[model samples]
Target: MNLSCGIIGKPFSGKSTLFALMTGEDGGGKFGPVRGMAKVSDSRIDYLSSLYHPKKTTYASVEFIDVPGVSGSETGENKMLEHVRNTESLLAVIGAFEEEDCDASLQGEIQGILDELLLNDLILTENRLEKIKHQRNPQEKDEFVLFSRLHEALEENRPLRSLDLKEDEQKAIKGFQFFTLKPLMFVINIHEEAIPRAEAIENRLREKLANDAHTGVIALSALIEEEIMQLPEEERPAFLEEMGIGEPATEKVIRSIYSLLGLISFFTAGEDEVKAWTIRKGASARSAAGEIHSDIERGFIKAELVHYDDFAATPDMKKLKEAGLVRLEGKEYVVRDGDIINFKFNV
Candidate 1:
C-alpha cells in the first residue's frame, strides 16, 4: 500500500523547507504540489541486511505531497483542498521560531489551521447531504444517516477523526476523503536557539491535544535539519551530536507518521534481499504476505516467524530453531513490529 501524506501550513511556516529536508528535494518555488518519497530509517533493517548479506536492502517509505503554501485567498484554499483530498494523512507545520510568546502563538496558529480544515470538510459534508436528500436509492438512506452524524460533529467544530467509526462506515465515506477525518501531525518548526527548549514546546502541544488520539506533535528546527541533510552521510552523526539533537528530524517525522497512522513494519530477509514491509497495526500474517506477493498469500500455509530481538541474540538459524524460537504461525496470526517472517508457501 502507498502511505501518502500531505504537508500543509500557512506561508512562511517553513513547510517547504521541512519537505525538502525530509525528501531531499528542493521544490520550494513550484506552483503545484511537489511529490517525493522519504525512506523510513530503521535500525532493524540495518541489522537484518548485515546478517543476511543481501544484495538488495529496502526500507519502507512514506510518499509526501507538499502542496503550495496555503494563503487566505479562496483560490489557494481550493487548490490545496484539491491536492490533498486523496492523501491518507496530513502534516501541519506551525511557525514557532520568531514568536516571543511561542506557546500562545503556536496554539493560535494550530487552531486557525484546524478551523479552516473543519470548515472545508463541513462544506463537503453539507453538499453531500443536500445531494443525498434528492436521491431515492436505498443506499443513499444509509449514506445520509452516516453523513448526518458526520455533519453534526463537523458543525460543532469537532474533527470527524474524533468519531469512533466502524469499518463499513469508514468505507462508505472513504471516497469523500474528509480533511478532518485523516490522521494529522503538527510539526512545530523552532529556531536554533529554541533547541534546548524543544521538549517543553512539544509537551505543551501534547497537553493541548491530549484528548485527540488522531493528532500528534513534534518539534524540530527545519533550518538545522536542512543543514544536517546537506552534510555527507559519514559526517552526520558528529554534527547531530554537536547540535545536541538525539535523532534526525526526518526520522522522527517518519516514525511519528507511522505511530499516528497506526502502522507497523515486518521484515522478509534472505541472501538475495532484506526488506521491510509496512502494514496497519494488527494485520494478519496472510495480509502481510499479500503485501509481499498475492501468490504467497493465496498459497498461504504458515509463517515461519522469529522476533528480531531473538534473532539478534542468537544470530543463528540453527540455534534459534534448536531453542524453539522460530515457530510457524497460521494465517490468522497477528503480525508484530520487528518480526522477521519467512512465509512457507507453494504457488
Candidate 2:
C-alpha cells in the first residue's frame, strides 16, 4: 500500500512554500491539493545499487499531499480536515515568519491546531454514534461497541492515537480510519532572523511534547528552503553550512515521519535491478514477498537472505556464499532493517 502524508496549515502560513521546496514543484494554491512523491533515501540501497550496478534502481517512497491552506471560513477548514482524515500522517506547519506572525504566541498556535484536530475527530465520533444507534443489526460485528468507546474518548478531548486498542478490537474497527489515530509532526516555519534560535525552539517543543507517541517537532526557515531551491545544486551545500543548518528541513521531517510510522526498508538485489521495499518494522518474510509480488508470496518458498552489512563488508556474492553469510529462511522469519532477500518461489 502507498502511504500518504497530508500537509496542512493556515493560509499564508508558509505551508505551500514549504511544500514547493520539499517537492520541487508547485503545490496547489489556497484551495486545492497537490500530490507529490518523495523518494526515501537509504544508504544501504545506494551501496547495493553500486554493488549490483543494475539497469534499474528503485527507492521506497512516501506520497505527500499539500492540502489547501485552511482558513477562518468553515468551508476551507472542512476541506483541510477532509484531506487530513485521508492521510497516514499529518504535517502541521506553524508560521513563525515575521510577515505572517499575526499570532504572537507560537505555543498557542500549536494548541489551536491540536484543538481543531480533536474537534474534527470528535465530530466524526458523534456522527458515527448516530449512525450506529440506528443500525439494523443489533450484533453488527461489535463495531457499535467499538465506536461507542471511541466516542467517549473523543468527548474527553483525547486523540484516538493514544488509545491502546487490542488486536481483536483493532480488527473490529479496522475500516474506520480515524484522523486522531494518525501520527503528527509539527513544522515550525521561522524567518531567517530566528534561524539561530530554531534549535532552541524545537528543543522546547520537544520537551513539551515529549510524552506524546508518534509525534515530532521540528523548526526550519522556509525562506531558506525557498532560496535553496533557486540556487545551483553545487552551491547549496556551502550555503547550508553558512546558515548553520546540517540538512534540509524536508529531510529531517521525512526522517521523523519514518520513525513515527514504524516503517523500515529491506532490499532485493540482482543483475537486473536493485530495489528497496518498505514494510512495518516487525513484518515477516511472507509479507515482504507480497510487497514484491503476490505470486511469489503464494508460492511460499524459503527466502535466501543476507544482512546488508555482511554483503557490504564482503563485496562479493561468491565469497559471501562461501563464508555462509547468506542464509535461508521460512516465510515466518521476521525481516530486519537491512535485509537483502531473494525470494525462492515457483509458479
Candidate 3:
C-alpha cells in the first residue's frame, strides 16, 4: 500500500524541522507543501536481508507531506486542509518547550487544531445534509442518516472516528474524507535540554488527549533528530547511544503511525529479493497476496507461513520445519505482523 501522512501545525511549531528529519528532505527554503518518503526501519527486514543476502532489499515506507504552516485566516486554513484531506493520516507538531504556560498552552494548541478539523467537517456534513434533504433515493436516504449522525457528533464537539460505524457505513462516506475520521498523532516538539524528561513530557501531554479516540501523543526534540541526521551513517548509532536516546525519534514516529493507522507488515524473503509488504490489520491471506500482485491473489491456494520470531530463533529453514514452526494457512487466514509468507499460487 502507498500510505501517506501529512505533517501539520501552527507556524513555528517545528513541523518543518520534524519533516526534514523524518524524510531527510530540507524543505526549509521551499514553498507550499513538500513530499518525501521515510522508510520504516524494521529489524526483521534487516535480519532477513542479512540471512538471505538478497540482491535487492526493500523496506516498507510511508510518504510524509510537509504542509505549509496553518494560519488564522480562513483561506490559509482551507488551503492547508486541502493539502492534507487525501492523506491517510496526520501528525500535528506542537512546540512545547518555550511556552510560558507550557501545559495549558499545549492543551490550547491541540484543541485549536481539533476545533478547526471539527468545524470544517461540520460545514461539509451540514451542507451535504441540506442538499440531500429534498432527495428521495435509497442511496441518498442512507447518506442522510449517516450525515445526520455525523452532524450531531460534530456539533457536540465529537470526532467522526469516535463513532462505532460498521464496515459498510465507513465505505459509504469514504469519499467525504472527513479530517476528524483520520488517524492523528500529536508530536510534541521539545528542546534538547528536555531530553532526559521526554517520558514525563509525553505522559503529561497524553493526558490531555486521553479521551480522544484514534489519537496518539509522543514527544521528541527535533533539534536532536537534526543532529542525528547530519551525522555520518556509521557514527549515528554511537551518537544516539551517547545522547542516551534508545531509538531515533523518526523510527518512533513511524512505528506510532503504523499503530495509529492499524497497519502491519508481512515479508517475502529470497535470494533475489527480501522485502516488507504493508497491509491493513486483520487483512486476510488473499488480501495480503494482492499486495504483491493481483494474479497471486486471484490464483492463491494457501500460504506457507513462519513467524519472524520463530525464524530468528532457529535461523535454519529445515530446523524450523522440523520443529513444526512452519505452517500452511488458507486464504481466509489473517496475516500477522512480522509473518514471513510464501504464497502457493498458479495463474
- The clash numbers for all candidates, in the given order, read 0, 0, 0
* C-alpha lDDT of residue 99 in model 3: 39
Query: lDDT values of the candidates?
Result: 0.89, 0.83, 0.89
Instruction: Give the local distance difference test score of model 1.
Output: 0.89
What's the TM-score of each model vs. the native?
0.97, 0.92, 0.96
Candidate 3 C-alpha lDDT tens digits along 1-347: 99999888878889899888878887543457889999999999999999999999999999999877866664567877788899999999988776373777878888998998899999999999999999999999989998999999999999999999999999999999999999999998987877887888778878877887689888888888988988899999999998889989979998899889999999999999999999999999999999999999999999999999999999998999999999999999999999999999999
**lDDT tens per residue, model 2, 170-212:** 7776666677788999999988988888888888887766767
Predicted candidate 1 versus true structure: per-residue lDDT over 1-347, tens digit per residue: 79999998878889998888888887455578898899999999999898889999999999998987867654667677688889999999888778595687788888888888899999999999998887879999989999999999998889999999999999998998989988999999998999888888899888988878999899999999989878999999999999899989779998899788999999989999999999999999999999999999999999999999999999999999999999999999999998999999989
Instruction: Estimate the lDDT of model 2.
Output: 0.83
Error of 1 at 190 (Å): 1.0
Ranking by TM-score: 1, 3, 2
